[model samples]
Target: MAVQDSPPVPPNVATTGGKLTGSLGVGSIVFMVVAAAAPLTVISGTVPLGIAAGNGAAFPATYVVCTAILLLFAVGFTSMARHVPGAGAFYTYVERGLGRPVGLGTAFLALLSYTAVQGAVFGYIGAAVNDFVVSHGGPSVPWWVWSVGALAVVGVLGYRHIELSGKVLGILLVCEVGIVIVVDVAVMVQGGDAGMSTAMLSPGEFLSGAPGIAMIFALAGYIGFEATAIFRDEARDPARTIPRATYLSLVLIGGFYTISSWSVVSAWGDEGAITAATDNPEGMVVDTAARYVGAFTGDLVQVLLITSLFAALLSFHNVLSRYIFSLGNTAVLPKQCGRSHPKHSSPHVASVVQVATAGLLIGVSALAGLDPVTEVFAWFAGVSTVGIVALMLMTSVAVLVFFRRSRVDDRLWNTVIAPAAGLVGLAVMLYMTAANLPLLVGGSSTLAAVITVVLVATFLVGVALAVVRPPATVVEVTTQEEKK
Candidate 1:
């Protein structure tokens, strides 16, 4: 017996809207970058410790360095993007630069990591929405509903114009940045709390909690910048626009995070900065703003924080869905995933599938008797961080290899040394995330070990499916007989 070709819609797969045009300008790309980072500013993995370890005035410096590192990687990464346009940013980069097997594995890894991020953000936003509703005398609905609601909206938008998504992201992002800026200015103008300390500038504190820790936090601010190449097709000009957006997004987000992180420290006064953050890391930024601007402003900031998260959900959903579409384009995934909407020119079908999957995941988590806040951070968010770090390293290698042949341009520095160095940094971060999983989950290392295993298992399943190969489409187009 031979395997039969199937025509049924495959599970966990969908058709994609084909390649997007390079019309996205520097501004839209900038929005995606901020949209990715806005949520991190408020809902940090370990906000309390940030003030103590490299989160003070020096935080900006740390971000500056990380941004430079990513920009360096982009120097080579973008050069390669000009040569290849696909939805799988990392996978496309690696496969074209490395080999098909590596690309296949990269795609699998990317789906796990980025999709987990999408689910993770849903959990966070769900909790926030639930809390807000209950506090306002509304019925205390479960977090699952919020997650499902967000998934639906993302699906609707994902089926439309990339420009529209960018516009929506831009509006929310501008608001987020505005709020952070308001708080930062208030803190500075009010002269901060009691005794001010320039000690934040000292590198001594940067290494207090293992030199790797500071570097690890710094890396968080750079994660989404790698997607610039992924947006090449949608970019206005792949040759120019994508690279400009790549470097520009990195600097803005990096500089913003560093400035805001330090602002929180200054607002508390160095003496209580760490203690206050430890006491209420998530709420500390709110409190810091309240201390200077009063309760009204603080509460307002919290509300905006909720909105900021929604923006993040929208952003990651786009990235995750695009990867799905890219998979289809490469034939590792269903042909449907490679399609583009005739009107919207986006991956409409892939977006719908992604939304449905995200909804199912949040529902499952809610039923599992888990704490949405902490558990989601540990199980999904932490895993995504580890995955992103690993992919960054791979992308760096891809860049180095892809450009290895072109000696005419100074590929040595842009393509080789700089990205190679970045790979080293990201590898260190991956190791730290694994070793300190407990820290990421707000649990003991023992528990973290178990959680790490779960994440790895999830990734393995994705890889297994890819290796097995999904049933691909066999589309047949019929045309009128040629008029002889």
Candidate 2:
């Protein structure tokens, strides 16, 4: 059933008391979402791995395929935003369509996915900072030390006005995108190693050599794009801004990934790219920069990579804090987490909790002597990819059901056709991701199994909590209402 024009609520409960407020326009929201994608990190880190371990030179095509699926998903997703506007995003949409328990479960899964990704970035950035410092003749500080320092910086930004975070992300995103584009142009202009070729775009090549693994990495790059709706409460003219930002974020992210990855393949010569990536996945992108542009450009890219990671951290901090804030406001979490800062109108309490939680994860990982990049980053990021893809699949189905039952906005394409197409596409992605989890998490089947169990358990725990203590704010829509 459609959301009630006015749902009844208890007098003591205050829905608007701790409400978050801001005036973020489409540009600001796009920056926040795209920055979280961390273009430099994806190109310099994830792309090489995808080429080596996945479909080789054809890995670039995966982005094109994923973009198509998600654009279809966005059709229904943005349409829902016009009706069910809230900070909860997927949680709100799923609840309005499905039911309270499933919606709560989706929220828990979203939290797990976003938090895991932020933790993964923390691990990666820590290692990157430590390496950069030692390379420049500085004392070799531990990676965790750098991670904690970065956490403190992000914590401060997340506690302030959202526009401040947006502005910072915008600056960092431009620099990172600029450097990659420069390298791409330089490689293209020089005719690449064996001249530019389009053979990599062929369907046969895309299906070559563990394509499922390639699909996982490609989808991971677009993780933050779907979070556009999480900022609904802060958006200026959300009905317009949210949809515009959603489509724009996908186009920019997808286009950059597709072209930049093709340029990287060209830099190595299409035939030899796989071997190069396999030999030196970490340094392939940087070395390419030095070769095509100049040594100084390589150094500049390394610095920008650090900033890109920091941007991702800050953007995710904002997204995760709002999810917590939404839960708090709905009474699923402690009400203190619902409170916005009186001055900044930010979700300061939830922001603080998110920082503490991330810090705790970093500490535990360090104490356990886990390799930050291999174990901490790989494992957490792998889990996040699986969780997010699953959430999207569920959301696609939710959109179809909501529109059909409620008879809200009966446009055939937006409500029925597009959501159905997206659902099928996402279902395939979820299966591929699940099947190849071992590769994504560093080739450990046992660890992959454990991650699967944890994800399932987390979603179930949310379902159980909802069953035991139904959230007061979650009104149950009846069959009679659907008939209305």
Q: Give the TM-score of each candidate.
A: 0.87, 0.95
Cα lDDT over the full model 2: 0.88
What is the TM-score of candidate 2?
A: 0.95
Superposed Cα deviation of residue 105, candidate 2 (Å): 0.7
Q: Give candidate 2 misplaced runs (Cα > 4 Å).
A: 1-16, 473-484
lDDT of 2 by residue, 275-375 (tens): 88999999999999999999998779889999999999999999999999888877789878888888898999999999999999899989998898999
Best candidate, lDDT-wise? 2
Name model 1 segments beyond 4 Å from true. Answer: 1-17, 43-46, 52-61, 194-197, 405-409, 444-447, 450-484
RMSD of each: 6.3, 3.3
Model 1 / residue 233 / CA error / Å:
1.2
Estimate, for each residue in 439-469, the C-alpha lDDT of model 1 and write its tens digit: 6667677766765676566556655665576
